[model samples]
Structures are given as C-alpha cells and as structure tokens.
Target: MTVYIDDAVHPWRDQRWAHLMADTLPELHAMAAQLGIPRRAFQNRRSGAHYDVPAPMRERAIALGARAISRHTDRELLKAVIANARLQYDATA
Candidate 1:
C-alpha cells in the first residue's frame, strides 16, 4: 500500500495545506501519526478520507516515504486515490 501527499496549495489560516491520502486507512493514519498529527484530525467525509497537512508537514511526509502527487501533473493517479478514499469512507460510514 502507498501513502500519497498532494501539492500544498490550498490556502487556509495564513498557511498553505495539502491532502494526505493512502491506499488504506491504516496506512493513512500511520503516516499522519508519523507526522505528529492526531487521530482527531482525520477527515472522513464523502469527498474523500484524508488528513490536512501544512506545507512544511507535507514535505516531512514526503521525506517519510509518502509519494508526492500533483493535481496538475498526476491527474489519473490522483483520481484513483480519491476514488479509493471515497470508497474507504463509505465502508466506514
């Protein structure tokens, strides 16, 4: 299973953020934990299960072995990951 971090381009609270996703929830949560993010931070919505990480934390996630994906250059892979995440959310819900 793979963990993926997208480009940290979403602006919020005076900082840029990114989405952290994975092939499985366990992997996703594990990566978030490794990045010092709390379990309560997990987003389990229909849009897709993910963790919102700041730009700096996004870089750390990449260094910790999460694959970096771009919405601009990695459209297809991003689609698949999001689909899987949605499915995960549905299963849990």
Candidate 2:
C-alpha cells in the first residue's frame, strides 16, 4: 500500500496543513506513527478519513516514502485516494 501526502495548502494557525492518507487504514496509521503523529489526530469524519499534517511534516512524510500529490496537478488521483480512505472508514464503522 502507498502512503500519500498532499500539498500543504490548507492554512490554519498561521501555518499550512496537508492530508496524510493511505491505501488502507492500517497503512495510514503506520505512516502516521512513523511521522510521530498521535492516533488521536486521525480525522475519521464523513468528509474523508485522514490525518492533518503540517507543512514541514509533508517533507518528512515524503522522505519516509509517502507519495506527494498536488491538488492542482493530481486532482484525479487525489480524489481516488480520498475515496479509498473514506471506504476504509465506512467498512469498519
């Protein structure tokens, strides 16, 4: 499974944030662990299941083997990743 980190363009708290997702929930959690992110930070909402990562964390995630995706350049694949993430949550919830 592949872990994906989108461009950190969501602005909040004076810093940009991005979504950290994976092909499956387990993979997603594992990557989050590697990134030193707590499980409590997981966002399991209906919008999509993912972790909100900071801009700096985006580089770390990429270094740790996450595939970086840009919302402007990779719209279609990003949508698929998001759909898969939501499916994982839906199946278990």
Candidate 3:
C-alpha cells in the first residue's frame, strides 16, 4: 500500500516523464493530490493505471514521500507495482 514513482526517463513533448503509481487507486490519487497534480492526468489504461509526471514534478513527488523505483534496477518490484495498478483499473472496469 505504498505510492511509487519511477525514474523520469520516458521522453515525450520535449520533456522527460515518469510514471506515478500506487498499490491502490485511492493511494495513487491521494499522493497526486498532495503533489498538486490534477486528477485528469490519471492514465487509466490496460497496461496500468498511473499518472505521467514530468521530470521536475517527479523529484518533488519523491521529496513529498513517494518511493522511487527504477525499471533498470528495481525490475521485480516495479513489475509488482504495475500489476497492482492494473488491478485498480480491472476492478472498476
């Protein structure tokens, strides 16, 4: 039941982005609210439920207590988190 953010390395629109995820949808939205992120940013996709956070915001999210996970170094843990995120969408849809 923890909030997690991955490294801001995904590139798009001239900016690097990160994925913000949590063990549950409520926790994810709560943390995003704390980070001043709008709920409209939530990406409820088949891949996973997450918010695409920009690089600068990613750092702020980490400072605000989001655990950082890396695709390169924390593969197993990150996979588990993604699995949890997917369940969030599946439960509702």
Candidate 4:
C-alpha cells in the first residue's frame, strides 16, 4: 500500500499545508503517527482517512518517508475507479 502526502501550496495562517492520506484508514493512521501527526486530525470519508498538515509538519512528514503526491487528482489515484465511482454514487444517491 502506498502512502501519499500532497503539499498544500495554499495559504492559511502562518504556514503552508499538505494532506496526508492512504488507501486504507489503518495505513493512513500509521503513517500519521510516524509523521508525528496527532490522532485528532483524522477525517474519515468515503475516500479514506485524511489529515490537513501544516508546513513544518509537512516537511517532517516527508522526512519520515511520506511520499509527496499532487493534491489535485491524487485522491482519485488512491481508489480504483470501480470502487471509488461506486462510493461516489452511493454517497450521492
């Protein structure tokens, strides 16, 4: 399973940001812990577990071996089309 952390180039407060997520919740949580991210940031969604990380933590996360991915379209890359599409459908309906 691959872990993805796309740099959040957007501005918010005194730092930049990023998103730490994975194909599975367990993997996502594990990576978050490795990156020193607190458990309070976990966001459970139809896609997966996501954490909005700040600039400092983003670098730390990268140092901890978090693979940086593109924030755009990267979310879709995690889930197979069939599964994700189905999930989206279920969510909408």
Candidate closest to the true structure, highest lDDT: 1
Clash count, one per candidate: 0, 0, 0, 0
Q: Candidate 2: where is the Cα deviation over 4 Å? A: 90-93
Q: Write the per-residue lDDT of candidate 4 for residues 3-93, one digit (tens) a residue.
A: 6677678678877877676656677789888877788877555553477788777777777777776645665664442253234222432
Predicted structure with the largest TM-score when compared to the true one: 1
| Candidate 1 per-residue C-alpha lDDT over 1-53 given as tens digits, one digit per residue, 9 for 90 to 100 | 89999999999999999999999999999999999999999999888999999
When sorted by lDDT, best at the front, the candidate numbers are 1, 2, 3, 4
Pairs with backbone N, CA or C atoms under 3 Å apart (clashes), candidate 4? none
Cand. 3 Cα-lDDT: 0.91
Of the two candidates 1 and 3, the one with more favorable lDDT, higher being better, is 1
Tell me which residue pairs clash in candidate 3.
none
User: Residue-wise lDDT of candidate 2 within 1-92, one digit each (tens)?
Assistant: 89999999999999999999899889999999999999999899777789999999899999999999999999999999989887767645
Query: Which window of 10 residues has the lowest lDDT sum in candidate 1?
Result: 84-93
lDDT of 4 at 46: 57
TM values, all candidates: 0.95, 0.93, 0.92, 0.65
Q: Which parts of model 3 have CA positions greater than 4 angstroms off? A: 90-93
Question: What ranking of all candidate models by TM-score puts the best one first?
Answer: 1, 2, 3, 4
Q: Which regions of candidate 1 are displaced past 4 Å?
A: 90-93
Better structure of 3 and 4 per TM-score: 3
Each model's lDDT comes to 0.94, 0.92, 0.91, 0.65
